[model samples]
Target: MTDARVMRDRQASVASAARRLDDASGQHSGAALVQTKAVGAYPAAASAYYACTPLRIDGPETEGAAVTFTGDPSRIIMALNLGSRIPPVGTRLIIHSSGGRWAFRYDG
Candidate 1:
């Protein structure tokens, strides 16, 4: 009986660990500097961008960079990494991973 109890505990621990790993793995991480053009709305619009080249992706920064950091900036849009989040600083394109399954906060 003791052996069975021990085995059950170990299995539970393993399952918990696996769940954590799975959740962590899916979490995106990274940021980049990308140029963008005014498409559709001014800023309320999301995922409505293209051509995220001349990018300078790096470590963690914001939700924007996290979802788009797949080691490749291609097939993603990046926000301007300068000035204000507005036109004065130029609208920045939030970078995302493939298929645009990511999201970002409201820009300023």
Candidate 2:
């Protein structure tokens, strides 16, 4: 039989893991895939923000490769579904994770 202290620790660890799973797999989700909008023809660049409505995608990203980033510019552009007004190539994307603890811009 495990010691009382070990049992308590195991319980705590399991509880912690459950909480994280719920948080990451919640209704709002943790990491979001964003699509930037076209600012205009001026400056030749657009902002990395301007979130859109979730397409009610319920499967994994791989299940929806037509929406996720697949390293192919055309695929991402079509996946964004922002309309033909968007630039032919992809736009700048600055992802902020961990409550703003990490942020980096992706121009490719």
Candidate 3:
């Protein structure tokens, strides 16, 4: 009986730990900001092919380098890191990731 109780407790602890980890992972995965830019009148299918290049966002006392797309500066978008979801359309941001440049759109 005592052994069975101990096993049950251990299983419960493990499940709790797993739930905590899952919550943390979800929180870490999401869009952080939006950016915007304008581009030539190309088909919507070509929007996802925009090339991203490294650039710096200047500040008064600090400068941060980030990846930016080359194109019209009027379209809005957002920036996200790896594992983060892409922001919805109309929202603009410049995302930075270790992986190569790519674009994402929210399905829902």
Predicted model with the maximum lDDT:
1
lDDT of 2: 0.36
Question: What order do candidates take by lDDT, descending?
Answer: 1, 3, 2
lDDT of each: 0.41, 0.36, 0.37
How displaced is residue 68 in candidate 1, in Å?
21
Candidate 3, run of 10 with poorest lDDT: 22-31
Q: What is the C-alpha RMSD of each candidate to the true structure, in Å?
A: 11.9, 12.4, 12.7
Candidate 3: where are CA atoms >4 Å away? Answer: 1-32, 50-89, 93-98
How high is the lDDT of residue 89 in model 2? 33
Global CA lDDT computed for model 3: 0.37
In model 1, the Cα lDDT at residue 25 comes to 25
TM-score of each: 0.25, 0.26, 0.25
- Where in model 1 is the C-alpha error above 4 Å? 1-29, 39-54, 57-89, 93-100
Q: How many clashes in each structure?
A: 7, 0, 24
